[model samples]
Target chain A: MKKILLLAGTALALAAGTMTASAQEKLKACWVYVGPIGDFGYSYQHDQGRLQVEKELGDKVETAYLENVSEGPDAERAIERFAREGCKIVFTTSFGFMDPTIKVAKKYPDVKFEHATGFKKADNVAIYNARFYEGRYVIGQIAAKESKAGLAGYIVSFPIPEVVMGINAFMLGAQSVNPDFKVKIVWVNTWFDPGKEADAAKALFDQGADIIVQHTDSTAPLQIAEERGLKGFGQSSDMIKFAPKAQMTSIVDDWGPYYVKRVQAMLDGTWSSTDTWEGMKEGAVVLPPFANMSDETKKLAEETYAKIKSGEFHPFTGPIFDQAGAEKYPAGAVVPDGDLLGMLWYVKGVDDKLPQ
Target chain B: MLEAIILTVITAATPLLLAAIGELVVERSGVLNLGVEGMMVMGAVAGFAITVSTGSPLLGIVAGLVAGLAVSLIFGFVTLTLVANQVASGLALTLFGLGLSGLLGEGFVGTPGIKLPSLSIPGLTDIPYVGRILFGQDILVYVSFALVLAVSWFLFRTRGGLVLRAVGDNHVSAHALGYKVIRVRYLAVMFGGACAGLGGAYLSIAYTPLWVENMTAGRGWIALALVVFSSWLPSRLVIGAYLFGAVTILQLHAQPLGLGVPSQFLSMLPYLATVVVLVAISGNRRATRFNTPACLGAPFVPDR
Candidate 1:
C-alpha cells in the first residue's frame, strides 16, 4: 500500500512539471492603463499598441491588461500582481505610474518593466515617452494662420511639466506664424471628464476664442467646436470622425512599433533598462492629413512636419522668452531635453498664468 | 456674452436638476438609493446606443429612461424584496452598473450622437439676450423644470404624497395602518431611476453628443449631494442645482481671467460652495427635522 501511494504521488508531480514547461513556451506581456480602453483617447491608443504586439508576434506571446487602474497606491499592487503571475514584461502606461513601477522593479529584478511618459528608470525598469509637443508646435502654427481673431482656446488637464511644456511649445509655434497671436488657457484639473471639458470649451469660445486646442483626453471639446461651427485640434488619437468638419488635424500617438520592438527584445533576451524619448523622426508622433484649412496653411503645416521629421527644425530653438519677458534661450541655441522635461514656466504669449 | 453664458449654465444645470428631483422622490419614501451614478451611466450608454442605431434622439431618450428603470428594478428587488442593507446594495448597484455599461458601450465608443433638436418658437428663440436662454433649449431642459413642478405638486398636495411621507416618517405605523410600505417604496424607486436615466440621456444625446465610458462622470453623485443640500424640499432643489451649476461654469471662466489663483483652488470652488451652503441651510434645525424622513436608509420587512 505504501509503494502504491508513492508511485501515484510521483506520477502527479511529473504531470504538473510538464504543464509548467508547456506554459513557459509563450512569453507573457502585460499592460496597466490609467483609464478605460473605451475612452478612445489616451488609453485607447495604448490598447491599440498592445493589439499590434499580438498581431506582429503571434503565437509566441501571451498578452494581458488591467484597465482603469488608478495612479495611486493601487498601481503598485496591480504591477506587483502581474510580476507575481509570471509576466515576463509589464508595461505601466501613464505618467503617474512612474514611482510605482520603480518600486515594483526593485523587488522583481528578473522581470522587465516599462513605464510610458515617465522619467524614471532602474536596472529592470525602462521609461519611454513620445514628443507630443512636436505635433503641438505644428498645430499652433495652423491655429495662428487660420484664426480670424488671432486667439485660440487652450483646454489643459493638469499643471504637470508635460502639460506646461506642451503649452510653451504651442505658444512658440503660434508666435512663429504670427508673433502677436494669443491663447486663453483653462485648466480643468482632470484628465478625462467630458462634461467639464465641454463647459471649458464653451466658456473659452464665449470669451471670443475662434480656434480650440486641448491637452486633455475626450472628444467633448471637439464635438462642441463642431457644433459651434469652429475649428479645433485632436489629441492622442485621430479623432477626425468625432469632429469631421471641425478637426483641422490630430496629433496621433503611434506606440505600436515601439511596443512590438520592446516585446521582441524581451523574447530575444535583449531587454535592458533605457530612457527613450522619440518623436516625429522615429515615427513615434504622427499628424493626420490637414483638413478644414486653405492650401497655403496646409502647405505650411506639411513643411513644418517635414522639417521636424528630418531633424532640421527643433521647436524649442532660439529666442525663447518666459512669461516675465526673461530670455530662456538665445537665438541659435537649442533647449536641452533635461530642461524641457522639467519645464515649469510658460512662454511669452500665453495669456494665462502657470499654476506652479 | 451674457446670453452664451446663460445658455451654457442651463445646459449644465438641467442634468443635475433631473437626477436630484428623482432622487428626492426616492428619499421621500424612506429608501436611500446611492446608485444614482450607476443608473445615470446606464441611461447614458443606452441612450447613445439606441440613438446611434435608430437615428432618432426622441426614441433614444425613451430607451435611456427605460434602461434606468430596469436597473432600478434590480435594486428594488435586492433591497426591498430581499431585505438587504440599502446602503451596501446601493453601492453594489453603482459598481455593477458602471461595469455593465462599459461592456455594453464598448463598441459605441467614438460614435457621434445625433443631438436632440432645440425647441424653435420662431420669435421667442430669436430675441436678443433672453431669447435663446428661454426658448432655445432642448426638450429635456423644459422637462426638468416641469418635473420639478409636477413632483412638488404631487408631494405637497396629493393624497398619494401624504401616504408616502407617512410611510417615510413611520414605516411601522404606516404598515400597521394597512398601507403597503414596500409597494410605495418600489414605485418611488422606479420614478427616481427613470428620472436619472433622462438626465443621463440628456448628457449623451444633447450635451456632448458622443458616447464614452463613464460619461456621466460623477454627475449622479453631485445630484445625490444636491438632494441633501435642498433640505428634502422639491422647490429648493432647483435653487441648489442651478447654484451648483453656475459655480461650476463660472469657475471655468474664472480660470482664464488669470486671477493669479491656482487652478486647483478654482476647481475646488464648486465643492467648497456646496459644503458652505449645506451648512448654512442645515442650521435651521426645525425645517430640516420637519422634512427629514424618520425611517430613511432603514430596510423594512413585512410580517410573514
Candidate 2:
C-alpha cells in the first residue's frame, strides 16, 4: 500500500539522520502504543513491557514509546520518528501496524522489528502475540460457575481475529463449566471509545449478565461491574479496585520479561525473527489478584488454571458445536489455526451471531 | 421496547444534536470548519483535566468549551484571514488536537472516571410513563433537550439567525448591506466550536466520564452528516440524532434476542445508515437547493 511506502521512506530518512557511532553500544527500543499507556488495557500492558526492559536490561537497553498512534499516514510518521531515533529494536503494538512494520523493517534491515498480533514475518521482522483466547476461556469457566442463568456478556470492538478469538474462547470455557452457558455480545466497532464501551456493558448488565467482559481498550466495563456488584475480569492489568468483591480474577498481559529478553538478545547477538504465541504456560498471560471468591469458586478457578497451564485441558477442544450445532470441534481435538484466526461465527453456547 | 429505545435514542442523540446544531450555525455563517473532531477531542481532554483537578464537573465543562473555542479560533483565523484550504486545515486541526489531547489525557485514560449524580425531580420523576425514560437521566441529558429547542429557536426565529443565514448565503451581499460578514462568521465559528467542545465534555464529565484517546470516535463526522440529514433544520436534527441513538441501542439488544446476526455487523448499521441516508437525502434536488451556502468550503478573499 502507499501507506507502507511512505512509512518506509520516513523510517529511512530518520535512521539516516539520527544514527551516531557512540562509544558505548546502546540498544534503543521504540514502542508504538495504539492507546494511551494509562488505559490499563492494550497500551498500558505494553508500557509495562517497556518498564520491564528498563529494569531487566538496565543501562544496556533504552526504551522510548509513543502513545495514541492510530493506523494511518499519521502512524507512519510516528514510525519514521521512532526509526530516526536510531532505535535498534522497535515494537509496533497493534494489528493495523502490520504492513507499516514490514515496510519500516525493509528500510532498516539491521533493526530488529517485532509486531504484535500479526501474521507477516521476514528475516528482519518478527510477529508475536499472547494466547488471549486462553484467558477468555478461563474466564468463561468462572462465568459458568457464577451465573444462575449461565449468561455472559461481551463488549467487542470489531469482528477482527482478536475479538472473534475472545468470543469463542469465552463460550468454550463457559459451556465447559455449565453446558448451557450462553454469551450475549455488543459490538461498538471501535477500539477505544469509553462512552460506547460503557453503554454496551450497561445494556448487557441490564439483561442480567452477572459476569461481563470487553474486547475494547477501556476500564468502563470493570468500573460498571464494581458499581453494579457483579463479577468480571480485567483486560490488560489487574483491575481489582474496580470491582473488589465482584471481580473473580482478571487476565493480565506480562510483556515486560519478553521485551527485556528481546533487547538482551539483540545485544548478545542471539536475536532472530520469531513468531511467538505465548500463553499462561510460558507466563506471558497472567491472572489478576482474585477477589472475594468463595472456597469452592477459588478451587474451581485454580483447578481450571492448572489444567490450562499444564496442557491437560484446552478450551478449543472439540465436539464443540457452532450456532447451528454442527460439530465444529471433535472431542479430544484442538481447533485449527485457520479456523481460529478467521473466526466469523459464534459457538453454540453463545446466543449472538457474527455480524456481516 | 419502545420506551427503552426512545430513552437510548435521546441519550445517543444528545451529544450529536448539540455538536450538529453548533456546526449548522457555523456553516450558515460562511465558515466551513471540519475541525469538529479536533474541537471535541480538545473539549474531552480539557474537560476531563479540569474535572479531575477541581472536582467540579461544571468547571470541567466550561474548560472544555473554552479549549474547543480556542482550537476553532485557530481554524477560523487560518481559513478566514490566510485563506487556506478549509478541508486540509480542518483535518490538520483534528490531527493536532488528537496529538495534544493524547499527551494531556495520558494520565486519565483507564482510571475509574468521576461519577455523576443523577438529578431527581419530585413528582415528575415519579410519574408513570415519563419517570423512568425522561426524568431519570443526569443533568447533561436534560440540558441537551433544552439546547435543541433553544438552538432551533435561535436559528429560525431570532434576528441573529437572519444575519447568520444572510452571511452564509452570500457574504458579499451581507457586506454590502452593512453587515460584518467576516466578523459574524468568525463569532459563529467560535460559538459552534464551543458547543462541539461542550458536547465532548459531556462525554467525559457525564456520559462516559472517563478520558480516552479518540473518545469521540466518529461522532463528530456523524454529527456533520446529521446536519445534512436534518436539512440544517434544528428540529429535524433532533429527530435524526435520536433515531441514530435508538439504532445504536437497538443493536445491543437484537443479539441477545437471538436475531442471529453478529454484533460487528450490527455495529456497522449506524454508519451504513448514515452513508445511505446521506446519499438519499442529498440526492434530492429541492433539498439540495437550500443545503449549501454559495461560499461553502471556499476561502473568502477580502482584496481579491
Candidate number of the best lDDT: 1
Per-model B-chain TM-score: 0.99, 0.93
Residue-level lDDT of model 2, residues A1-356, one tens digit each, is 01111212232232111222232466778888776676667888898888887777756766667666677666677776788778888899989888888887788788888999889999989888988888888788777887776787888877787788888888878777788777777777777777677777778877877788888777677777777788677777787655566678888889887887788888889999998888899899998755666677678888888898998987788888887989877788888876777787777866665666
**What is the DockQ for all candidates, taken in turn?**
0.52, 0.41
Report clash pairs, candidate 1. Answer: none
Error (Å) of candidate 1 at residue B238 is 0.2
- Give the whole-model CA lDDT for all candidates, comma-separated: 0.90, 0.78
lDDT of 1 by residue, A75-120 (tens): 8887887899899999999998999999999999999999998888
- Please give, as one word, the docking class of candidate 2: acceptable
